[model samples]
Target: MTHVPIRVGIGGWTYEPWRGSFYPPKWPIKRELEYASRHVSAIEVNGTFYSSFKPATFAAWRETTPDGFVFALKASRYCVTRKVLAEAGESIARFVGQGIVELGDKLGPLLWQFAATRRFDPDDIAAFLQLLPRTHEGIALRHAVHVRHDSFLVPEFVALCRAAGVAIVYAASADYPAIGDVSGDFAYVRLEDAREDEPAGYAPAALDRWADAARTLAAGGTPDTFPCVAPGRAPAVPRDTFVFMINGAKVRAPHAAMALIERLGAEPQR
Candidate 1:
């Protein structure tokens, strides 16, 4: 079992003015990334949706980060388009073969994010998931599926990932519907923007709730696989989870992640 502390990372983009209230006024992409990297163990790149990454970009990222730092790249829109699996099979294969494989060791999991409008079609989804390449020796990477709609948050939907050997994302948000389903061992949990006005920053209460849930899952091995979506506050590495924080205004991921590292680090060694 790996004892690495929870791996946390900020969401890809932090440049949004976001209602005119964020630091630096002008978020420098590279700088923000470097800062987050210094504190968190991994980051999820949400930029691959609109633009194709040049090999140089991946190489530059590798050059910029430390050895253990990991990157979870979102599969481009082109790869997860609404087209049928058969239609997009070649594109998927090509993207993985050309794009992700090129990332070398920095690559973590390839995230397959389904748009809100993209409803789950059992037949289509099953076929699409089946088309994804399985484990490879070159990189011990797997695919993580994130659904941005209410319909895909059910047991059946989670089961799809389990059957496919993929991880399903657990997102935390004020606007989204409740998360009642616990799908796979490797799950993804995200703690979105809370607020600085209110009791912001992964409140101790929230952490306790999550920690309790995590312990339950850990003990029973219920959600056998665990990846995480987060405010960079959730634990991942040592516990087999992944955390991504999309909320940067009220709570900086570095601050929250460092706090979490200290807390987890202080726990009695087991």
Candidate 2:
């Protein structure tokens, strides 16, 4: 089956610049999102866990942004604790439901970012997985399982996700084992900046190689993997792709995204 266009975005809003030339300016949330939307189609909300999503904020977000934009929310800490796993279905359900309601239709995916100490407990994982409702009929929902510490990305986990019909997120970080065998109509790739000295965006030479590889992967249904090498640069694999680079200095997401769009020869967004 033909896949949807790969939707690429960044991790969050705002960035700190090292140079004194461009100082950071305080802006409204909607304005920030609207500015981001000009280049990136989506963003991952890391702050969602730090604070609850008020209904009013969600309304403002929907009102200020254009249509066809997306947001990926990180699940709250309370929803994934050891206590919640012990017969706390109501709590988890309410949390997820509230997140969906607050994010509304623009919500793209729910990221399940596990703690560093949280290991792979088959029973716990299954229990947590069962608590979530399936993706809505018209909406696309992906449950991204991110294990911070050592955890097995075993075939069984991939099988469970396949059966459940949830897209698993694959983050390309240095020194991390590449998890394969994910089954879903869609997928997510996070390219975090690994090189501190390098520029805070995509590297041109690297993009040349990755773009070719991505096209090759798209031609066939074979499995492919992309790893973060630098800002805006990832080793592209075959198949549909959505890459979000999280390394930017003073709001460089748009610049990096524009670079990638030009590298891919894909239509520019703005």
Candidate 3:
């Protein structure tokens, strides 16, 4: 009856500082994803945001990582950075048809990020959501949206996302608004408050707290203390949870992700 799982990791694998601290001394640059995927259950890939990669590249990535590892890709800027979001169908189609299915089951959620200046226009956002294809190349796709503007805090936006089955990313950042409402069957969390001083990137107690939070999310429950746009709660049902240690104190992100993985108990990334 267990239909939920929690995945924790960092954004991307390559970092100059992690060469020694996170990776083995003088580890081969080409095998960084292979190494990173072993230590964590999931990784949020940022490279897809600016450009496109051939199917072979995605296939190679899948072969390098372990069986249970999952990679979440950021949607292309071309799809989210335009004035007319609804008109992005062509761009969205290009990105979706770009042979990403090469990753097979290793592929996870696609994060669509909007500019901070972009306010919540219910109709525009809804149109853009409709443009997102539920399935591509016979593979089911899960979508998550990240909005930096505070104007997205309105209940209307939350209700819209909920109806569309697209997750609203819980961005734990001082500059962006955090919405912990469960809009989809899955939960996406972007933690951006890592500290340089803490070796684990976060205090021990903080990691413990996040571990608990992740458990709650996987169990189809939202933390009551977290910020929410909607007044009422969604029906609690088992949900897969994804948490990535991102931005803030970027250098310490890997450590923070590893810490979370350790706390969650390494059970072969299932």
Highest lDDT against the true fold, candidate: 3
> Model 3: per-residue lDDT, tens digit, 69-152?
888999999999999899999999999999899998888999999999999999999999999999998999999999999889
Q: Is candidate 1 or candidate 2 better by lDDT?
A: 1
lDDT for each residue of candidate 2 in 1-270, tens digit (9 for 90 to 100): 112355567777654441221222555543566676656666787777665766677677766555666677877777765544546577556556563654556677777776657766767677777777665444456676666554655656666665665656665566444454444555656665434333535567755654554454454332444432122212343445565666433245545555666667654245
Off by over 4 Å in 1: 1-5, 13-32, 83-86, 135-137, 178-185, 198-200, 211-239, 248-251, 266-270
What ranking of all candidate models by lDDT puts the best one first? 3, 1, 2
Q: Pick the candidate with the highest TM-score.
A: 3
**Order of models, best TM-score first:** 3, 2, 1
Superpose all Cα atoms of candidate 1 onto the true structure and report the RMSD in Å to 1 decimal. Answer: 6.4
| lDDT at position 90, candidate 1 | 74
List where candidate 2 sits over 4 angstroms from the true fold: 1-4, 18-30, 83-88, 102-104, 135-140, 194-196, 209-241, 247-254, 265-269
TM-score of each: 0.75, 0.76, 0.97
lDDT of 1 at 116: 65
Candidate 1 lDDT:
0.60
Q: Count the backbone clashes (under 3 Å) in each candidate.
A: 17, 5, 0
